[model samples]
Target: MQTDPTKDIGSVFGRSWTLLSSNWIIIVPAIIIGIIAGLIAALVTPTYYMDTSGVYPVPVYHSMLGLSLVVGTMIATFVGMLANVVILTMTTGMAAAAWKTGKAMISDGMDALRRPNVLSAMLMLIVVSLVLSLLTLVTLGLAGLISLVVFFFLIYTIAAAVVGGFSGMDALKESFEVAKTSWLTTLIVVVLLGVVAFLATLLAAAFHFVPFIGPIIAAAISGVIVAFFSLVLVGEYNDLRGRAHPAVAAQPPFTAPPAVPPL
Candidate 1:
């Protein structure tokens, strides 16, 4: 059966929270590793401050320091990218669990990665990301206008492929179809979820104050946010999908009229 499209979009957060809080025990382990990685990112990432309050040129770092800074920044950039991917895949595991599979618990979500079709779905995800990244850049962020309209749209492709066992092409078709339901609501849900993601960063920063397990704390926080966000996607997808194809009663099969006298 299809979901009711008239549901209040704002309540998505409340439903997400309810689902997440209810499944904490099953959700925590999967995300802790990712949040820990984010915490490590904070440590390796350098902080720069240039005091220009002095003379016209102001005080700048020494030549050696400048060269070192450039090298450090380059290395840090690479490392940060890797950390980001790790966190993305980790949280994506949760999203897949909630979207592709029926269960939303952490373990089931993590286990989604082990599915045979997951490899294809993941490859598709990477392809979509690269193409979208290029498109968004080529437009000088203008593609973000479209992205805002359908940023989470492609995930539907992967979800259908994995969950519904549909072919990649079919999944791709379904994604756009479902995306057409309510652009405004989709955009709002995305922005709200992004705030939760940023909160994971804040949690990582806060956990840095902890003694030995700071990174671990951060990773756990990040994971929890992913779980909540994933559940929200599940709810939103159902609503939009229902709007796309509302349920219809099954039709009765036709029966041939009883044979009468031959003509």
Candidate 2:
């Protein structure tokens, strides 16, 4: 298999950085939502202190676990998941705009959150999480390799939904088709992105002790980092879709639609 110059990992990585640097404002919505989510979490969760007995500072809860605690935990989990999906979809919209027209707008990101797109994204998230959890259990906590393969193939699901107007399972199937044709490139991008996210988490953790603003600062850092990751995914998705390949032949060829109309 010959490598396409346009799909070179270095080139794609460089272009992603260029887009991120030029369109840093794309992260504004993410930061805003992150802060809001952090505030909600702070208000809902029980107070705790860090226990330093271990090498890591483990959270120690003083409050007894009860009905309120369970309810709060559920609420926090739901909010966190919704916040992530929103950030991802918004970033996908902005990144597609940047890739297609050399400019990105927060409105473009908001526009991408149409009912069908949001519903599809939410379903995909739930299904994927369940699938991965099952795989983890079946593999006895050794599902990392299988999970990586799964993620590499489905990485473009949001981008496809936002850019190609695909939805639900169609979006996931489209991503898998595109990924298989460019397996090497997609896999490399996946591994690189995983590294970036890991590093970003470490960087964000450093802000955890800054008093009242700590969680806010950490949220902002995480939002920006994940937004960059989403941008790169969009870039790769567009590039892969633009090419002619047998893998995507069963469906109508992807074109840059004038607008992603609300459902």
* TM-score on alpha carbons, each prediction: 0.59, 0.75
Q: Write the per-residue lDDT of candidate 2 for residues 49-87, one digit (tens) a residue.
A: 454567443323323435558668767766776787788
Worst 10 residues of 1 by lDDT: 245-254
Per-residue error at 110 for model 2, in Å? 0.9
lDDT of 1: 0.58
**Per-prediction CA RMSD (Å):** 9.8, 7.3
User: CA shift at 55, candidate 2, in angstroms?
Assistant: 38
Among these predictions, the greatest lDDT belongs to 2
- Assess each prediction's global lDDT (C-alpha) against the native: 0.58, 0.77
